[model samples]
Target: MRQSPALRILAGTALALLLGVSFTQAASSTKAAAPESSESFDYGTVDSFAGAFLAARTAEADRDYPNAIQFYKKALDFSPNELELQQRLMIALFMNGDFDEGAKLAKLLEKDPAVERVTSVALSFQAIRDGSYAKAMKSLKYEGPNDLDRLMNELLTAWTKVGEGKGKEALKQLQDLKGPSWYSIFTNYNIGAIASVVGDEDGARKAFTETVTDKNGGATAPDTYARAVMALATLEANAGNKQKALDALSAGDELITNFAPFKALRDEIEAGRKPKPVIETAAQGAAGVLFSIGGALNRDGAEDTVMLYLQFSRALDKEAADTLILLGGIAEKAGQPNKAIEFYRQVPETSPMRRISELQLGLTLAETGKVDEARAHLQKLIASDPKDVRSYLAYGSVLSDAKDYAAMAANYDKAVEVIGPAPTRNHWSVFFQRGIAYERLKKWDKAEPDFNKALELNPDQPQVLNYLGYSWVDMNRNLQQGLDMIKKAVELRPDDGYIVDSLGWAYYRMGRFDEAVTELERAIELKAGDATINDHLGDAYWRVGRKLEATFQWKRALASEPEEAQVPAIQAKIEKGLPPIEADAAKVNAEPAAEPKKDDKKT
Candidate 1:
């Protein structure tokens, strides 16, 4: 079953702290190391150490890593003994892509517990790169601040054991490293990878099979699941089980449909060629460790920290399309769409992920206001592969954002045609989107059935329930059923402010002014900055005879950037209160009340 949007967001947030670094240890150590002085670089030549320090801190806060690095260096010149400065500088250097310099500084501060976690991870990567297996193991031996840290320490240590040609010991280490439920996928995948490299096909197959079947691990750590599938496929291919290898690839496709490596291996199998091993060397295995953890952290919204680990992985395996895609995603999340474009552009054209990257690049371009270029790019994709639902979805999404409802509806119509009439549960989104487009175009007759079809395909989808129910209420038809649906939607997605607003608005439409005021107030609290909800609350307040509060809310709505078409009416409401009930009633009685327009924004 598909996870709800709210559930996904909550999961991501919860997982963000899963790999806790010992912040308390770092903080206490930082205080003790603050006052030391060194004679390394002359500082008297510079006028104000305090000013440079403040500027460096400000730059760090602003994420200007380059400037922060420069300023921190200048500050360090004056106070070479300051451990805090070294720690900040090392982080700044790392973020600025000067890993060598960062590692060097980290080595000097290796004994300081405050920066121990960061320093240890950095120095270990350096040692692993230099073929210093013993040194890498030593660096990883230090106690980590959190469960995530401890898990990584053990995993990396196992990889180091493999590096030292102790494959049995490495497997033993992984077998014994107890951790949270989420850690099983990583450990098993690593064990499978190590066994593959050591020619223990049976062991590799058993480990990979367990990893593949782990549902919790698969949902929480999809990249590791994908890797485990690839490892299993490689083992099967080596055993001359061509069909089994193909089946393994198919299974992986269900987790990551566009993974380039899996697609490459599947092609080799189809052509009756022996596929290369998933992990042939200890170095690559170690790189995979970093890549898996980094990908998981990125999903958990720790983009800044994940980027550094991914860079380390990329340095080891430059051709890793997964790492590149992840980096692009991180850049996009950080609001560097142009940087994201560069990363996406770097995906090798032969990779299946390249198509997904192109889609991302097109979307990023549209986000940057290059709508024409985005449209052309997506149109070309559609022309190249008319059967690719993603291309049509991307094109339709761009049109939807641009408020071109007609074009959006037409695009989805094409998608529906491509998908044919035998729509499955997976095709529910297409119907739902088409419904939204038609509804936005004010074609209620066409829109309502599509929504119904979506509900038929995916029963109890809260978004569909909220939208269809709200429409029914707005039109004053099926009032009780509409209210029931809205209530059910609220139950399903209690935290959705838009759905709550719909409930409040339904009450207002029924002229239950007191009830409307109560629900609308709750809705406003839930969606504090929403112009439509605020306006709805204002109308409800006025109906309840709270003229002053109504005017205040109308003014707030005006300031909140309501639709251009809505501005004049809102402004008029603010300047002059709503017309009297007698006049409104007379008008309503003279002309049969037309169905009220529903809000354009969907839940």
Candidate 2:
């Protein structure tokens, strides 16, 4: 083991002690022989000090702090200038909680750098506890072992100020630190608490936001963000924005589930009462932690971080509009439609981001089969902005999804009317959608022109090509041209299951069963579990004389309920089996396979 500098000092003292002992004996003899006025000290003092030092060491070894302190103090009194003895005494006194004596001894021996640096910090903390603010502050000013130690002293100073009922002053001291560390944010939150106590709502809000939003600000915890949210809510409530306040408070409640401050604030808000001052104060403290972490987590994609943020956000703010919207998206991604709805509902109708929030909310609601509510929100959006092409398009899209051809066509017309003469890709989408609405309604005359217009506007758009080609094939008209269009679509979107299915279906319609089988098999690879793709493959297989395989594929497709509109038709097909192909008809007229024995059941 390496020898410490102090240990080296002790080791070198033994030789010096030998010389000193001989000199002291000679001086004492000379004084005793020739001097009458001056008295010589005996070796008794040295023996007594040595005895005390041994007693202190024995006590320290036994972990008896009280006995160690007494023995060390007696040794120090006998040999006051012995640095090592004084050091031991100070340590033992501190260990015994006799900080007053320890601090005094440490100061008296301040020339020792270690004593000055380390002991001063301990002394300062003790001074604060002893109600000597000035002395604590003075002790804190001395240099220390590390930054953490220095920070501890600084924190003690702040505590002293707080004890003196100067909370604002104490907060100011903490707030003055600008370092981007955990401690810095913690200090800012402390400042917020002071500001709140002084009725400085604006100051509190600013501090809270700084802790929460600033990427490098000191605050860093979910609870901190919750506090910031609650603080903001209180400010809004005080300013008469009742709904906004409720939203903010509710959101905070959701974020800070375990914190009492958020719950207290929530209860007050719910009861139409003002938050108590202490609630604000405590929340300010939590805000420091919450904002510091929440801001970072907001961008971190780790599931754990996101989940932590989610849980914390839920605790602090129940109706946090922005957080709710974000959480809603996360919930939807996690396949929790109900949870998503709960979050999306927090976004206010008057919010500038309402359109986006409402759109997501409507979609999630529709996923959960709350179609009426989804449509109502869509209608509200349309009513508010009749010329908003997005609202019209969304409403029309939803209607089309429900297979409500008449309503979808009406919405598509309004979308087209508002988007007249616009030379954009969106215009092409509008035309294409309208054509689909017409086609679904079986208005072939109306569908044809719009489809042609869509093709002209967005040349070679694969979806449009597939739709037009599939329509021609379905009607058994222009088979060659329909096949050509579908082949082009297949080339453009080889992996698109719907387009691939259309290409295969077109081939089947033209009685090119081999080509149909190839495309349908490829479609199944691209879109496994797609009911339509499975159904198309089954038809192609039957046309190619794969009767048993066709039956299996058809059963799989029938089991897959793709959407509400397709469910009934697919179920009906499952009950009745697929339409007879030319190959199947030939087999029926030819011969059947040999019947199995009664004991040899089908595997």
TM-score of each: 0.83, 0.45
Candidate lDDT (C-alpha), each:
0.75, 0.59
- List, residue by residue over 430-472, the lDDT tens digit for candidate 2: 7887887887777889988898888998888877787887888
Clashing pairs in 1: none
Top TM-score hit? 1
Give Cα distance to truth, residue 476, candidate 2, Å. Answer: 3.1
For 136-206, candidate 1 gives per-residue lDDT tens digits of 98898746446666777788888888889999999998998886667788999999999988989899999
The RMSD of every model to the true structure, in order and in angstroms, is 6.5, 25.5
Worst 10 residues of 1 by lDDT: 589-598
Lowest lDDT 10-residue stretch of candidate 2: 594-603
